[model samples]
Target: MVSAGVYLVVRIFPIVQASVVTMTVVAAVGAFTALITALVGLVMNDIKKVLAYSTMSQLGYMFLALGVAGYTAGVFHLINHAFFKACLFLGSGSVIMGCHHQQDMRRMGGLAKLMPITFVTFLIASLSLMGIPPFSGFWSKDEILGSAYAWGSEHGGAYWLLFLAGELVAFLTAAYMTRLLILTFAGKYRGNDAPTEDFVEDQAKLQSEQENWEIKKYDRSLGGLKTLYREDEEPEKHEEHRHVPRESPWVVGASLIVLALFGGFFGFVGAVPLGITWWQGFITFGHAHHAEVNWLVMGISTAMALGGVFVAYIIWGAKFAVFMRLYRTRLVQVLQAVLANRYYMDHFYNGIIVRGFMVLAKASRIFDTWVVDLIVNAFGAGTKMFAYAYAWFDLWVVDGLVNLAGYMWLGIKRGIRPLQSGYLQHYMLVLIIAAVLFWVVRYFF
Candidate 1:
């Protein structure tokens, strides 16, 4: 949704007029979204979510291609990504199911023995995703790169920047995928305590100890660790053991079949034609044609792919592989650690965006509580006091004035009580006297 919003803004708003800027913005948004989604998915402990994030990241690459106007190449990649990504997700689901809800690769080892079919399917899908030769991903990805290079040549520096970013992203992608493969399939089982060879050994030792105890109970003076027990107290004899490595033919066969098919028909017989001529249009940007195969380019590409495989082998392949022991060196160990941490990209984001936002949030909270809320609360308290004062004034002063007026009226009624009697002559004499007194007082004044 955020990506779509950004796209719309960049499209409708005339401020961002440059095509290169628009494309760059789109690529940036896409890449950010992919990276965020992938990280979230990985942290959430959901197998499906992991795949979803991977798909999102892969789509980011496609969008990057499309933004650079490599439409055909991007579309091709989108299709292939969908195919192999689906296979990978489903295959991973199968592995989870076979492992009885163990989605964590850390809990799994030697599953190539227990769930051979799942392993093979997973291997193929992983290879395809890694862009191994003749797999679906290689063709599409190469096309994207070729188109990016062509665009960079046709345009100016911007396309070149995009191409460089894409290449860097590709290297990271490979590294992470390699890490995933190593942790998933190549390690020793590191799960919780269960039935293992160590457990079996401990159990056998315990039984032997119990048997020896019983023998000691019968024979008081058994010398040292070597004690011959009575017939009744003898340890139960167990059969001899032999270690035999088991192979899952079904899984191996399925893997071999797909790999063989992909190897033989990947470039030439599959969806995209694999011949030199077919790739010529892509590599040359539809400018040139060659009548014969270009073994040189093919060889170089193959060598690069194989080089990646060899690197992976050296780092995390079978224990007996010649260079495997060399990976235990300090330099290789540090390199692996760096790769596993995604070259500190996560740390960088956390330091910049996450920690920055956290600081802003804390500051906002303090401002709201101390500044804004304090001012608002003060105003509210003042308004409430003013209202209370008005109520007090109305209750005391206004009511006191009404009461005084009532008291005056009552006094007038009491005074007029005497005049209510039948005394007209007396009342006229009193009124004449009151008038005489009022005139005397007025003249004196």
Candidate 2:
């Protein structure tokens, strides 16, 4: 659910193992997604949206990892990403609650003190996400990049593009994560609560003293920030206190704490710190190429990660006003505008592809409704008309001929009816007359 694309990548990994062409296609698509999502993530202001694009970007890494035949490395990265990203989401939830459900990072400046536990844990997870050292994400991501380099070195010049793309995505990952941390946890408080008390008073105070009023303590350490549960009071009596965001409940904090710890330290299990074979021994796949660490690839990838973070710090942290002024320039404004709109992907889809498909679909529906239904109705109407004609023919033509023959038979029977009467005198007279006539005729002859 977190990174659904990785499962698709895993399903296609076998194809890469089977055919070279499929591997190339998968790798190319993966590289494209990696770059695209990173660029999309850069201009986002919402915390969850940034993390969502980050998820997509991490999925790109997994796909590219599979592309280079790094099945174990890709799976490892998938597992590690799950732990760290879960921490990130939960921490973001904690921040949202503390800020009264504000999701825009622009409205959130300094929250490191307001939600200390969440901040610390989130920072740990962020570091892991950026592939910082001693973190689970670093171990897995390093292996994936190493696989790309290994593939490129063995294959040819074109295959090297996968490595370059992967490394570029890594840098982008660091940049976005660093930007998120700086904008969220390192600036001044932006809330309107008690705006008059510390209104432009002390700009030199440390992070914790200036931003927070509550005692610096984890809520879970004190039974998850308990309060008296009075049953007799009406709901409206304490309505104001109900929305105040306290530390997360122990159940939620416990999960975050556990995941954060794992995110920070789980890499040791498969760490490749001195060309060690610790991780590869456990993998059952017969990939002998990644048996040891490649220092060049690892070093280059780590340096790029650091460089991305530094770049983010320069833009968002050290010289925030200067960069703000820079962004106001026409060229930077245009770039931000394009990046903010996700390169007009929505416009292309909505104005072109979606509209085109809708037209075709409407045409198909009309054909089905009018044309096909009309033909079916015509067949039904024709069948009914033929039935009516057959009924009339049966009554007029067939029955009429039979009835006429019957009437002729009845006429003949009626004419012969007088001969059937018992008449003895008439018959004897007729016989005598007939005999006399016969003798007279004989004498004359």
Candidate 3:
């Protein structure tokens, strides 16, 4: 589904290529989307939410590549993204189910020791997603970055900004994904087996645990204009439940392993820098723009990705306390709030667009009842009156006329009956009377 739009643009390349304005707009939108979504992923607490935003960011990269006329690069990233992103999603699901529907990463830790297969496969896929070298994502994403830079060099303008934005998005992607791995699998267990009293104490301090608390009360009223109040319900009873997190089933593990393998090595078939053009040759046909791999761009992108990983490790892994102290500052909190709320897009959609449509629906209902229904009812009453008048005419005037005709016919038959009574004298008399009347009329007139 995510690939459909990119595929459409690729299929209609002639039209897209013909318009510079279109290409510029596509590139700008893609770059913006990639940057924004990467920012959003940095603050997510749910494992799946992080992955979801990551998928959107990757799509932005694909569009960015296409926008820069890097058709092969766009398609290459699409295919590689599918492999790694699918593995990541499946691994997240496996973790969720293994933890008995626990998607909150704060409640998960030290899963690597328990779910070995899942850990290995997830790490491999994450490496590819981070665009680490020798992995599939690195080859494709590097190609896109190279293509963007090359396009910008040939076509001077703000188009060069796209390359910088793509590089920034890559750094953020690596940072957040590293943060995810560290939080979910590197730290000590924070889940059901925790000391009961400490767990209860932590749960009671809702302010400190804003992520869990916010989900329960999603009534984010916008300046007292609208309040989305959810129904009240009883809270779940907490008990000292102890269960060890285990690896996913064999089927899930097997699938992850296969995807991890492809995600790990699939890029070898399309290494443009290495002159392995099997993938680009097949996909680009005659329109392929072959260029020597820009080693400078590759080095810079790799440095950015590795720098991101290092930064995430220092912040989330090594100095979590310091990170939290900074996280609690006013500036960071405000930024966090905005990102957590998805930039208030939901509020705008629900409060404006949805409510406007609802008001239009109500107005339509009123018009239908008062105007449409009234007109229809008036026409119905008029038809009923006309039908009654027609029935009266049919019963009295029409029936009466028919009865008068029948009576006249009966009288005429009676008057003519004597002439046909088998009497020759009567017959001759009638003939003579008719003949006398005819002669008198003829002579006088």
Candidate 4:
């Protein structure tokens, strides 16, 4: 919907002719929708839904670029969003599957210890989504924001407001993703139920079996025995063995390798065109279409994204500091509340849409059962009762007369039964007599 709305606005409203009023309105709508989607996703318990909402909000930033006619920047962001968002969603799915459908982060903790592959994958994706440098998201988001800042310089208050909002949303994005990681991987287990112990026992047993097999193979090789030997003939096995459950190193190593290649190559390619000359065929082609490098802008954008990561580390990373203790003050509590509630946007929507629908539903039910049904039911019942009385009269009086004619015909047939003969000719004559007798009886009656 956000993408469609943006495409519609860009196609219908010519950028050159659109007034500041139109641009501002389009930008606000896009930004607000994005922010709301992100906030809702953050609070959602379902992991997939959270990523879905995050996708919606991320696209809002892209749409904001389109609304401002930053087509290249928008496209760049769109491409980056695809990579990081897919990684995040899939990584979360992997975690959910590993944990046997436990998606509520509140119920999950210390998963990094159990499923390191999923944890590393999730971390890389989350960092990318947070717009960290060397990741795909950084280049694209920086381009979008840089364009916004440029627009802010020309368009007075509205564009500046949008730029500020984008910054705040960026901070929130980092904070919530950090919160997710901390709850899922950093803390001790806080769930109500304990994990099944059987899995641990099974893993231990498997490790022991693998160790015994390895030792047997080593013994066979050292003895210079080409043929297999019975276990009783093998050398004595060790009584104690260490159990180590390590993931295939290639899994984590391979993902990092791919992501590193993509992160380095995509940005360098995008930057190449800025420095190439016309004489340099391929290099010149890149330079012609690339964005002009503004060292100041790049520095500021890189600092913002890095600052977010640094802040996250200080609060929840491996070396978390105790700065949260200072937030115990009343003023700080109020500020935290405001941020947590998302500045009451959810409350405002609940009041307007949810409450309004509830009231409308109550009124509709009353109107349906009382006013509408009362009049219709009363009229229908009265008409039905009148028709039923008329039907009773018709059944007794009109039907009785018809039955009397049937009884007279029956009496005439019975009276002629005695005169009937056994022969065919005699029977035909008896039928004619009976018809004459019936006509006479009807005329006299």
Alpha-carbon runs more than 4 Å astray in model 2 = 2-15, 193-246, 274-276, 287-290, 320-322, 368-370, 422-445
Which candidate wins on lDDT? 3
lDDT of 4 by residue, 126-212 (tens): 777777666666666666677677778777675787776666567657756776787677765434343347434543554565666
Instruction: Rank candidates, lDDT, best first.
Output: 3, 2, 4, 1
Q: List the residue pairs that clash in candidate 2.
A: none
User: Candidates' lDDT values, in order?
Assistant: 0.57, 0.78, 0.85, 0.63
Ten-residue stretch with the least lDDT total in model 2: 220-229
Which regions of candidate 1 are displaced past 4 Å?
1-18, 27-57, 103-116, 156-158, 164-303, 318-326, 329-331, 342-392, 420-445
User: Which of 3 and 4 is the better model by lDDT?
Assistant: 3
For each candidate, give its TM-score against the true structure.
0.59, 0.79, 0.78, 0.59
Error of 3 at 166 (Å): 1.4
Ranking by TM-score: 2, 3, 4, 1
Q: Model 1: per-residue lDDT, tens digit, 16-39?
A: 324766756665665555444444
lDDT of 3 by residue, 385-408 (tens): 999999999988999899999999
TM-score of 4: 0.59
